[model samples]
Target: MMRGLPAFFAVLLAALLVSPTSARAEGPLVLAAASLQDVMVALADDWAARGCERPVLSFAGTQAIARQAAAGAPADIFISADRQWMDYLQKGDHLQADSRHILARNRLVIVAGEDGAWLGDPAAFLNAVEGRPLAVADTESVPAGRYAKAALTKMGVWNRVEGDLARTENVRAALALVERGAAPYGIVYQTDARASKAVRIAGRFAPRAHAPIVYPAALLKTASHEDAAPFLDFLTSPRAQAIFRRYGFAPAANDR
Candidate 1:
């Protein structure tokens, strides 16, 4: 009886191996920036619906993921919220040079909960939040935060509000602080404001408010050419660009 059980298990395993569904399986682990949550998830799901295996998505600050890639983490792809982190990985020889692509662009915005004050010009905006904690992504390490700081500095309000800043690990968390009314104001990506029902756009920073918000993607060195190539191709594809657009992202001008 024991011998029969072993033979049966071996046959089942062989059948499973040859199954058409398993034969085409590809599992690529993707590490991305936090602000990409809504759009990236939708893109991955769309890819899965088209028959390829869903790529595993890991979202966090670009700095953290850059550190992971530098540490030789098991990642097949990296999509950064800013180019600096991508440049960091490329310098470390952790990315496939030819596969690098600028996928999207975004702008910054100030958001407030339903009852929060409407934002106007920079000086008035600062006045509106005076003595109240203003939420933002951590400027030292987070791309969104750095951009927020740059925008504030550009508008000449950074020095005034610096003391009232409530920095969070990522933009999404900062958005949350506003959503739950913990903060009266939060600076985040325009796309983030679009995604949340709990918040509304109080104002948008000008194009020159800070450096351009760019999202760049690349296959990691540890990713197999066979495993990572398709997803990389799909990212800049018209279909994928459409998904990004639906989520409020501006397609990278050089996307073609």
Candidate 2:
């Protein structure tokens, strides 16, 4: 049995602010990157309206979710903020290879807490944080963190700031740290900066700073529900893609 749009949104909208692990995630499941939370909710809503059974959406760090899928967490669809995680799943035979597609794209940016300032120059901005910690995801596994580290390492500032990081489980948690003024700044997706009223854009990283940022989506081989296919198709449809663009996301090919 499928849930309806209004009911699902009512539950999911509230969970958007809650911790991902604690989220009441039920599914033919869709494990998504934390940064995609807002638009995925909209896409889910639209899917429900179209008479598709609602997907149970579990949001987490790309690595975290990928590990879950690799360890055999039950999911029908997986959307990763970076292609590497998707590849990780494919290598493990966790995905339905034919269903894989690049769904959207985004770029990285530096952000300040509501009380923090955007100084506009990369070197100067890094200097301003001084000895204070900057919020970031886990660089080794989290794509946002990896991109952040890449950008900083390229600028020759990683040596100075590496020990000063306040790492979070995911990008959104890093956003929360900055939003609440607990961290002086954070490296996050431009779209994440747009989603929060508590944070403001300080500067953007050049596309050359890191590997291309892509949101690759795919179906898992273990899904039990028929609803997963319709929801997956809705993701790249004009209607869903428009919702993505409205939130500052680009089509995946834009990065190329």
Candidate 3:
């Protein structure tokens, strides 16, 4: 029998149960990108250790979270993997403008499940990958997939691989496909590859290949929790940045 729910699912369930009129717990509710799973949990735990209520976290694609905010979800905070989604919420007046800021940054990498030196050259890698599916997030809506598409297009290989894609809902899902060998290869964040031992980083896309990977966060305009602003501040603290760096995320630049 299952003794307890997994951490991710438990938090997701908590988030789903929360509504505008419901009695909220003392902690802030955070809707963050799926790519932030491990780091966010660690940060929440660290906050709780400091005599604060742990933030309730919900992880999904940035698009999903942004949509939730647009629908006026009672969540207190939003952290997006890319600025586009954050901008989406801000445009809709869903977030507190002054509370918005860059959180952390990351790099894009190609990961592989099979053992081989097949990624040394993009052309050679494409040839080696011939018919196998290359997993990626949804290029039209998901940030990771959009970055991967830009990188591939810049390398002049997008057309060649377009027909062989295996798209998933989020970056983590793409990483999972590669980890499980359901797809021979995948394009995901460097932090994602670092989080798993099942897949190895085969190559990294140059920063110029796509827009900078920026994680922007803000307190929601609908925020009602007393801990919301404080928790948002905690995320940008040097202590939190250190944890992010430990997980392979780079310090956020003054990109705005």
After superposition on all C-alphas, the RMSD of every candidate to the true structure, in Å, is 9.0, 6.9, 6.4
Give the TM-scores of the predictions, in the order they appear. 0.88, 0.87, 0.90
Candidate 3 lDDT (Cα, whole model)? 0.87
Model 3: per-residue lDDT, tens digit, 44-85?
Answer: 889989999878778889998887777667789999999898
Point out where model 1 deviates above 4 Å. Answer: 1-26
lDDT of 2 by residue, 68-98 (tens): 6775565678899998898888989888858
Q: Cα lDDT of all candidates, in order?
A: 0.84, 0.82, 0.87
Which candidate model has the greater TM-score, 1 or 2? 1
After superposition on all CA atoms, how large is the RMSD of candidate 1? 9.0
What TM value does model 3 have? 0.90
Best-matching candidate per TM-score: 3
Superposed model 2: Cα runs more than 4 Å off: 1-27, 254-256
Model 3 weakest 10-residue run by lDDT: 17-26
TM-score sort, best first: 3, 1, 2
| lDDT of candidate 1 over 32-67, digit per residue (tens) | 898998898898888889877877677778887777
